[model samples]
Target: MEPVARAFAHVANMLFPRGCVGCDRPDAVLCPECHALFNGCLAQTLGTAEMGRWFACGWYRGAVRQAILSWKDHGDEECDRPFSEVLCSLAEQAGLPDHLGNVSREQVLIVPAPSSLASMRQRGRRHMMPLATGLASYLCARTGMHVRACEALENRGTAGRSVETGGTVQRSQRLKGRITTRGKILLKNKAVILVDDIVTSGTTMRRCVDVLSSQGAEVVTVLSLAHTPAGKPTKAGRHFSSEI
Candidate 1:
């Protein structure tokens, strides 16, 4: 932020005193203890995906849940930086640098998972785009790849609530044909790192993978800020999933 903008933000914060998004620690957007919850780089199996694996930064529970909900839906835009940093941390934890070492690509793409038109309007933006850009920037600096963040997918508004809010197989069924490609670029033959704020039933994530694959994009793996815990915790205390 510029000097004047920084001063204004500081003043606004002092007056409002929003505190931490997770635990409400004074002056902290995400307290260190809350941030620690996101460092696991939890892994899950996505059977339909080419990469066959995806990762989440934390489980969608407790303080992690509070932080994500505040940032994603309640307009705690300041959390973007902390959350994005967590994602970069996750990339490093998940051996992304080592994986990219093997792929000789001219460019890599960071693709944000799509939201419905209604959801975007409600949130005033595509919530995950900032994270995608941040991850792409980090990947460029880390891997020396010409990385680009692109809004390559869109979800036509669904009839009922999302799988996350509804958490039903019926809601998952509604996801079919709901998500589709939207950009001028087909994303053909390019590497894609899928980004989302949360992964719930994995229904939406799988549908997105299907859409990207149909367009010939080589999806490296899915990455989300948090996920609804649906499997046994590994011995390391990280979230792990069975075949989805």
Candidate 2:
């Protein structure tokens, strides 16, 4: 059965080659040009927010945005590779916190922002898990440290709301108290990094930090694929208004 499946896939590929996720160029998952574009914007951290220091590969634009959108909305799971490569590079460049680096791989864990159950069901996939798992793999491979992803966070049983609908204030208010951690509190005294696709206003990340801190997890840092550049003087400090 496996051989037959492989054969069919091979034939399908021959008939219709996969295009670059970022640029829609044929015959590659992600073209070199797009990869370089994202690589150029690597940074140690985006900005200091109430949640903690945030890091990102670059602004969510051009190829980066296309890659995320393809993976997140269209189920192009392979898109995670390039995205993770940049993220892992950022992690390496930024370096882990002293305490976290000193700890055994088994001690450090990556907690991804949870997608609402309804969204997960609708997509038939757990989006954050893939990114987190990819990042964990990269961290382990690069640093020889064990990295575990904890599905310890849970949505506060509210419908997943769009970040764009309301103004920053309204969005922040809507997200407040809408997410929580569940089951065993593994974060207690453990080093944890929160992973998300993007960070704009830091409201959601702050809320997550609040929950994790209450659970006693030593929140080391927060990471995102992209942070919206400071827009034209919005009331909310900097708004990650664009999807990176």
Candidate 3:
């Protein structure tokens, strides 16, 4: 931000006195205590062939859940920078540098998981674009490769609540024919890393992977800010399959 913008922001904060998204502590978007929850994040090897591997900053629960909801749905756009920082931190921890050691920047594409056109319009922005771009810059600096953030996948106008907000089976069925790659050769034979704000039933991520694969992109893994917890079996030991 420029000096003028910074000054304006400081004045605004003083007037509004924002609280932490998680704990509502004054003047913090996310406090250290809540932010600490994302450290040492675990990778969940979901049962999706296309997803290969999936990783997240933390499990979506408690403060994390509230924080994500606030940013994703309520137009808390200020959280974008902090969230992008967390994602870059996750990438650093996951040794993405080593993974791209051999591939030129041109051969690597950081792909944002597509949001519906409706959702983008509702939010007034492509929410994941900045985060993906930040991650691409990090990969470029670390690996000395010129990486690009490719908005390759798109969601067709499927009329219904998303899987994250509706029944899993029905949402999965609705998502099946809705995602596809842009008709371009940019992704052909390039290594791609998928980025999303959250992963619930894995439906969205898998659909993205499938479309990218169809476009001949080599999707290596997925990086997300959070994933819904895989809780205990509902009944008769039928676990909630993350790989819908």
Number of the predicted model whose TM-score against the real structure is largest: 1
Task: Rank candidates by lDDT, best first.
Answer: 1, 3, 2
Per-model C-alpha lDDT, please? Answer: 0.80, 0.67, 0.74
Worst 10-residue lDDT window for candidate 1 reads: 158-167
lDDT tens digits by residue: candidate 3, 1-244? 3456557867887899988887788879988987876664546664442344567888788888888878887666678888888988887776666766755434888899888888877766788888888888888888777788889888885534353567667667878888888666467778899999887777778788888877777777788888775553222121122322
Better of 1 and 3 by TM-score: 1
Question: What stretches of model 2 exceed 4 Å from their correct place?
Answer: 1-14, 40-52, 97-99, 102-106, 141-144, 157-163, 232-244
Number of the candidate with higher lDDT, 1 or 2 = 1
Write down the TM-score of every candidate. 0.89, 0.79, 0.83
Listed per model in order, the count of residue pairs whose N, CA or C atoms clash below 3 Å is: 0, 3, 1
Lowest summed lDDT across 10 adjacent residues in model 3 is found at 233-242
Across 65-151, the per-residue lDDT of candidate 1 in tens digits comes to 889888877666798899899998988887776787777656688989888887777767677888888999998999888888999
RMSD of 1: 3.4
Span of ten consecutive residues with least summed lDDT in model 2: 235-244
Best by lDDT: 1
lDDT tens digits by residue: candidate 2, 18-91: 89988989988878887776553333332432223566666677777887777776666667777777766666
